[model samples]
Target: MLISDGLGESVVERQHAVGNEVDASVQGIVVQTGSITGDVHFRGGTAGEAAPRQLPSATPHFVNRLVEQDALTTLLSGPRAEGAVLMSTIDGTAGVGKSTLAVNWAHRVRERFPDGELYVNLRGFDPVAEPMTPNEALGFFLAALGVAADRIPAGDDARAAMFRTLVHDKRMLVLLDNARDAAQIRPLLPAARDALVLVASRNRLDELVVREAANRMSLDVLDDAESRELLAHYLGEDALAGDPEAVGELIRHCAGLPLALGVVAVRAVEFDCPLSELVEELSGERERLDALDSAGETGVRAVFSWSYRSLSAEAARLFRLMGLPTGADIGADALAALADRTKRDLRRPLAELLRANLVEQHERGRYRFHDLLRAYAAECAATDERESDRQDTVRRLLDFYLRTSARADYARAGGDSRGFVVDLPDSSIEGLVFGTDAEALAWWDAERHNMRAATLQARSFGLNEYVWQLPRSLMFFFHLRGYADDWIEAYTCAIESARFLGNDYATAYLLFEMSVAHYDRGDVDSSESYAAQSLPYFEAAGDTHGKTEALIGVGVMRVERGDLEDAVKPLETAVSIGQERRDLYTQGASLNGLGLLKAKLGLFGAAHAHFEQALRAYREVGENVGEGFVLHHIADTHRTSGNLEASIEAYRRAAELRLEIDHRPGAAASLRNLGNARHESGDLTGAREALQAALGLYEEIDPDTAAAVLDEIEVLPTS
Candidate 1:
């Protein structure tokens, strides 16, 4: 604006400088908010330029969000401070339709921004791809603002500066949707108060609210009425009207999530089936998410995938593993245990999941999943994580409840308790340690359902050790708390797992424990029968340790039957073994029972002790991943020593980690090595299975290397 003293007002006016200051030394030309009396008028420079209409197609069937739409209108309809950009962070859980709302509202009010609306997906949460960077977004905005690709600046700062200058005076709506964070949207801001920016993300983007004074409006899952309205939008009112009950069930299944409702609606429209049939298909939690897939990006699972994939590896793993909890929510301590990490170590990953809106922490130290999201996460666990790792996570989860139950039991009992307690894993998450009786009881009450679920889940996974041990750990706790049904139900489950194992020692031990369970419930006849059955097997297995425990049950029956002399020897033997506190049960896993299970599985002799000794050491310290490598080594050693069967078992030695390592891939080379050993040992079927599995893994992690595994599979005898 600095010029010679005689310069005309038209000179400064043509430059779009609004306001006036007459005292400047270099400028005699000043433009003011004044009425001009001359025949000439000042006008703007940007005439006949093309206004960019860069917004993507807005959702056509958008309904509901009335409150949100109204809020946006009010926030954006008014004037703003000069150079103070208007922005609102539209954030919420994934698939809550943040982008859909922002776009439709923009189109509704696009007339105000006559220069045209500018929009970019930002792809900050693309399921399979990395987020678009600020430089990329800026380049996008510049190009939309009519900047040529070749003319675009090379640096982020320069491109951003150019974008601001280009849109500075224009009234426009810039939508930065699915943004990863506030930083990604900042540089794309036009910085003109007249321009409005709507930043949509799964995160709240608090920094934008604090620093930019950005207005924030978070979307929640629709209510029952809103969900029904949304369904009508896609399926039409008659389809919903045909079956009122199914409508209710369908809405419940969708859990008020708009994406799910929309997906279900589409399927409803496409199938032309009775709404009840669709309800039947989605009845099961396991298959509900499958039914919600629209076969595109907007599918419920696909939308969740975008947010899930935005996470770091640690956060992604936490998301999947969190799916394992059977309870409605998990405490921080249990999550740490499931992850084999300390609580302090889990904060970052937990925060990461929170940022991604993958999980919600409703209360302090407690987290839960959205119902549909929990299902999706469980599906991810089943598909994305190794079965072995899943098993390990559950195992650790079960162990946390089992071990902490024992600790709580001991503390609540004033230092005297019944269940067997192991030392907390040194390097792994040490389960909660209670400082008072009330603390122990409170945790027990809160985790009661989780522990019950753990027992059933263990048996279902065929984790026989924990199947029997968990109930045993809580046996006294249940009886003391008068949970008669829990005591009976859990012991019944334990007995089945023990019998299924067919280990005489383990079977007898559980039978003996069950007798006490019956005794606690005052069922003497059932107690006596269980005792008599247990003693024979204990003696058959030469388990003097277990036999002694059974003898007490026998003596109890004999004393009840009025036969004192016959009970004398059983009493004597019980007394004799009672003196041996450090028996097989107390020392560790009874080698006899373990040996029997190993024998049944055809992994006998030479490698048994080595696998047990090494694996026991690793697992005792809570090092499952480290143990995988060690087991691989042990298999290599067995193969070198020519014990092909043991070598095969070693490659498959993921049992103790309490997970099905199917989710974790053993190195393709190692799996191929196991295949060759199985072939050498005349186990053609086993060899073929191992090679095919290895080939499958390589196809994912290293397709180039998969050829060798394919060749290995091709050479196998078909027989």
Candidate 2:
């Protein structure tokens, strides 16, 4: 080690000097003596990875919280205890500004830790989406720590272990915001003794306090002075000084809650009359200001009502109808459909709502209400809107979903020659038009929850046509996406809707659809029962197309039951109808059933001939889904005949085709079969690879099947 000659001559002065230069060159480690003046960095093996700065921007115009802020900073600002992590929870009621205070303090002290800050809104109290699960939160944290998603292990325990290892000894801050409970936080606590974890939640998280020894802080609303300061920040000191009496009344009604005060401030600015007038109107509700602020019944409602009454008729109606859908957020176009207007026409109204702050723009072209605001808006809608008018609004909303989903389904399936289209005769509002399959799928992905809510809401309103038609629109999407539970629930409601309407044809179609869903999911007995129930209704309605579908469904059931001869009549009749009507869709179905029946009867030659015919029919009609199914059957036949190489090729083709169309369940089945074929050919590496991919697709869509695939992989030969 060398010390610079420029050092001060006096030893006492040099000892306390800043920026002293030292250089050391050694093959081995160099030992340094005495304290360093500035940052000390050891340059040897590697530089540290980039730290993630994930904290949300601190709230603006944050008035004053010297006491709570001091408490949080004091509790977590110090270095962690030896061999232990520092953890604290800021617990408070909703809208009490828990997140506001936590984020503000985090930003202030972030420079204390050179390592980056990490934050996630656990969404424990989110009104729109489910609270983030422990695994989801862990996945987020690991990804932030620079772990690639594919490299992250399955199961919470594995991910937690990896998270601890990555964060070990790092000086970091982890803010788990809005956590649901202690269980959601424990696994996320870093193993690093140098790290600080600050959590904010509406929940008290009593377990973390008692069991884990986490420091707890219960936040209160702002006191009178702080509340006045907050109002001054928003309205300025001039506005507060202009009318001290009215200002006092405004602050009192707000109950010192930051959110309430913010809304009141906005209303105060927007008010045309004097602030005294606004105060006078709200002063009547002062008697209900009991303990706990009673935000639901008293103060907050007064604030929301002021905002609500201020809206123009158009924006007011939009806000009221928004309370109808259970979805977290809605697109601008969907809102237009609710009001029988175009998206363009609603732009002004949406702008008005934004100005009033009744609806916050969620993302581009989408808007959402804060949960409390949503509840109040809903109450207003119930009180103001008539019964008939409300029902009509639901009809229009459902129609919008039905038409949009149908269009998306058509785009997704490449081309559906099935002649199914939603024709809304009443309203001018239109669903979306897609330029590509990706666009349609993206819409569905974004609007899936809204669509689900629309279906159920239609049922509640007794709009039977929409109840059935809306689900039917999503049938293809539900099938391909392996959303079996959503598919079943959708059809079950549709079936009941059809029954209520006494529509035999509709009932038959629904019943057959249900049977197909059941058959695809491997419930053979239920499939047969639903198929049997549909036959009489189809016959009663004199519907040949519906009858043919029912016959094909029954034929598949009989084939699965190992009664090939009994299946022959219905399959042949279905073929006859297809030939007479030139319905390629029916031809594809009947030919596929015959192929399955022949294969089951050990007639390989006949099965191949039927399979070839089915493939051609499906291809002619642009039915990629049916084509994939026939190819899968052909692969099954080839494997049964001991043609391992041919079976592998065919299964590979089927899986590719199914996956291309987003048919995850079908793809998983084909992949599982492909793995079995590869294993039989003594290609263990290929076998395991195929099985693992299959397992991943199945886990979300079919966990039981995933477990079965896992069993197969476990028993495979390592070599």
Candidate 3:
């Protein structure tokens, strides 16, 4: 039976289910009903009144996933008797054929649903526009279901309810492909038991599984046989018949991923190279990933590029910057630093990347790239990103690390001795401002690998100043954390870069910093060599501060080598030069060195005065780390002078200030000193408590110190 209505006209016609016929026409409209069964069919009508057939054609050369196909069929069939709407979610990683399976299944079953089919690419993972809103999806569904434009509700909930009401009695097949999540798909679901919905997504849609009772099917990379069959279907049996081994190698290289296989097959057909030769070219991980490109946008990188290009500008920029890190995953705060964007400002752009499936949020507030996608993003940066822009972005990242790490070092060490000469570039985003040493150390732990990579990257680009400054900024952190290898590698690059730029001041500063790093690692000879190299450069640059710092480095190395007399001479010279210039940092540093020298020589009163003067200078300069150091030194002088009470009080104050700054290592040192003072005073219980706390802090910041503290605690009196 057929019925048609147009502009206040009606026409009807009916053909016999057996032999009967019926027909009716009014103006331009026609309607017919089968005389035997009373079934009506409309032949002519306004297009709006007719059932909409919106299903896209099924994918060609689709091969194998028979199990998934069967599972879907069962889901639809099982739910029919319960009078409940059948909804199945197909979820998987990108290019895993979720969309293909959903669409193919929809086409296969279209005949069962007499009301016709509906389709929409929800574009949940599309990089271009925002994910389809529920209200928008409902409106599209309503129009397709023959609801007038004006009648559709304006609000999302109202539109959804209206859509459900309209589809309540009809048997229809609806395909919601590439949906972002259950929230976006909920409003578009039909209420009718007779209708079936099939959705595809990269996410599992677990909410739908729990709340809506959705039948879920997860798609995985095809099996070897399935991948082979699919490839043969595309390239023809004849093409693959000659070299079975090469075909197997090609499929293995594709990792049974359907998108990769399709891309490779398309290229295999277009090019004349033997499949074996192609496999050889794609053997390398980087080249293999890149080789999956097809001209029709089917290549792995090309497909990724399409998704990448669809992202908002900020999200796109973030995606490209993600390639800068060599780590497997990154926290958002580090990513914010890399992009020079505030963490708050990055939330939406990061969410956009998640929606587009360009990046995955594997853990709360942490994201990672698919291996192939990372390579693709790197390619995009190399090709599309301007050299100047890349350099500027990299500089911002390096500057963020340097400035923040310096702040952290000051909190921990009581002073930063590297002495930056070049002014840092202005940051577009507010850099991290750590309130505690713990916060700063945590940030450093997270970004250590990226920090190392940035130094090398800067060196490669001849950003000489950054190459030197970045490593210098990291020195204190490395010393406290005992990262000797990273310290040496970074300084090596910085030293070469400083020499390349012919900046005598930077060269001297870097050399002094390298000496400190090596000395911390117990490489006394290397430390002295670097310190000796720095002295002439400091003199050449006419930098009295640099000269003072270099002299201190030389003296400290001599003290470590047990050349007490030689150490005394350079240490005295540094103090004189620092006093002449009124360079507070260098002067305080030199005073501390002289204090240590005096203490080594058992000149307790002289050491006390040197430390007191250093403390005053450090306070004048607002260097809390320097104050902590001098306070600890004063405590040592008091202890050596047999004033246990004074030494205990000094250590307690140093520990308190160091802890406030989150300086775990410094706090531990003070606590260790305080414990010894308490033990000397016969306060065993107090000694134990202080020693245990010190051990815990040491364990987190320096395991070697923690072990020594443990030995000290074990030997203490239990009573």
- A best-first ranking of the candidates according to their lDDT comes to 2, 3, 1
Residue-level lDDT tens digits of model 3 in 1-719: 44444455334343444232334334454444434356545443333366778886687878758999999888766835354678889998777788778888888888898888888877576432245567667767877776544333334555666676567778898889888888888878887888888988889999998888889999987788899899888888888899999998877766677877876675666466688876765563333233333222223554354466668898988888786655446777667877877789999998898877679886688887755577777777777788788777667667766677666665656553435545554666455688876677777766665567667667766777778877877776775554565688788988888898798878887888788778756799899889889999989998877888888888977876788999988899999988987788888889998988888899998888898889888888877766887898899889988999999999999999887765556788899989989999999999999999997665444455667898989989888
Residue 458 lDDT in candidate 1: 78
Which parts of model 2 have CA positions greater than 4 angstroms off? 1-56, 63-94, 99-219, 235-247, 267-278, 284-298, 308-324, 380-389, 410-425, 557-583, 682-719
Which candidate achieves the best lDDT against the true structure? 2
Candidate 3 — what's its lDDT?
A: 0.75
Q: Of 1 and 3, which scores higher on lDDT?
A: 3
lDDT of 2 by residue, 1-719 (tens): 32323433212234434333334433333334456568867653223467899988887868657888887778765655675778889998877788888888999999977788999877677543456667667767877876644334434565676677667888899999888899889999887888888999988988998877788999887778888998888888988899999888877777778888887777777664677987877765533223235454337767677777778898888888887776667888888888777888888988998877678885698888766677766677787898788777777777788778877776776554653344443655468898978678778766866777777777767788888888888887777665555678789999999899898877887888899788766788899889989999988988787788888889989999887889999999998999899988889999999999989989999999999998999999889988999999999999999899889999999999988877777888999999989999999999999999998776544545666899999999888
lDDT of each: 0.68, 0.79, 0.75
How far residue 344's Cα lies from its native spot in candidate 1, in Å, is 2.6
Residue 317's C-alpha lDDT in candidate 3?
A: 85
Candidate 1 ranges with C-alpha deviation above 4 Å: 1-288, 293-298, 355-357, 409-429, 502-505, 541-551, 554-719
